[model samples]
Target: MGGEWFEVLRPPYLPVEIRWERAVADGLPADVSHAFGIFDTTLCGVQEAGMSPSDHWWLPERESACDACREAAGVIDDRRPRAMRGEDARVSVARRL
Candidate 1:
């Protein structure tokens, strides 16, 4: 019954989408199909049954997200290109590690 919502700022496929995930019980679902179905069901639900307080229609309060989510956002933000011509691309990738 107890679970935690973690924000995924930079999913591998879509870097710009703000996504949230629920890690309940032991951990997240290992199967992609299960994960997708679970997430979709929760998100598509009405009345915000299992949704987080910050989970609005379009605006989510990232600052209020859990520490893990915040950290992920930071990591993603850093890796994203900061300039048009990749001026900041020269930055060492090791920083992410």
Candidate 2:
């Protein structure tokens, strides 16, 4: 596992009372139906069992996201610049050619 984190909403339909969870990005089920039966433990110790297939996975704004999960997962601010390396450090595609 690369220790990547993902924001997940177990019950997708809820708008006002929605609380996003930070889950491990590795080994996520490819089939939505398969995900429903499995138990998922969030970073903040929330366990989700027999969840719905409608569960949504996305990056929500920090304000609406789970504070405990985010802190536990050590999520970095997206607005901050990440260090570039290897192929990603290339100045331009034309230079490579």
Pick the lDDT winner: 2
Give the candidate number with the greatest TM-score. 2
Worst 10 residues of 2 by lDDT: 8-17
| Tens-digit per-residue lDDT, 1-97, candidate 2 | 2222432212222221233433433354432111121256554455555333345542344454555545543443332234432223322323332
Per-residue lDDT over 1-97 for candidate 1, one digit per residue giving the tens place of the 0 to 100 score: 1222332222233232344443222233323211111432433232223423223222124333344444454464566555522322232223333
Model 2, runs deviating above 4 Å:
1-39, 52-56, 75-97
User: Candidate 1 — what's its lDDT?
Assistant: 0.33
13: Cα error in model 2, Å: 30
Model 2, residue 71: displacement in angstroms? 0.8
RMSD of 2: 13.7
Candidate 2 Cα deviation (angstroms), residue 9: 31
Model 1, position 56: C-alpha lDDT score? 27
TM-scores of all candidate predictions against the true structure = 0.27, 0.30
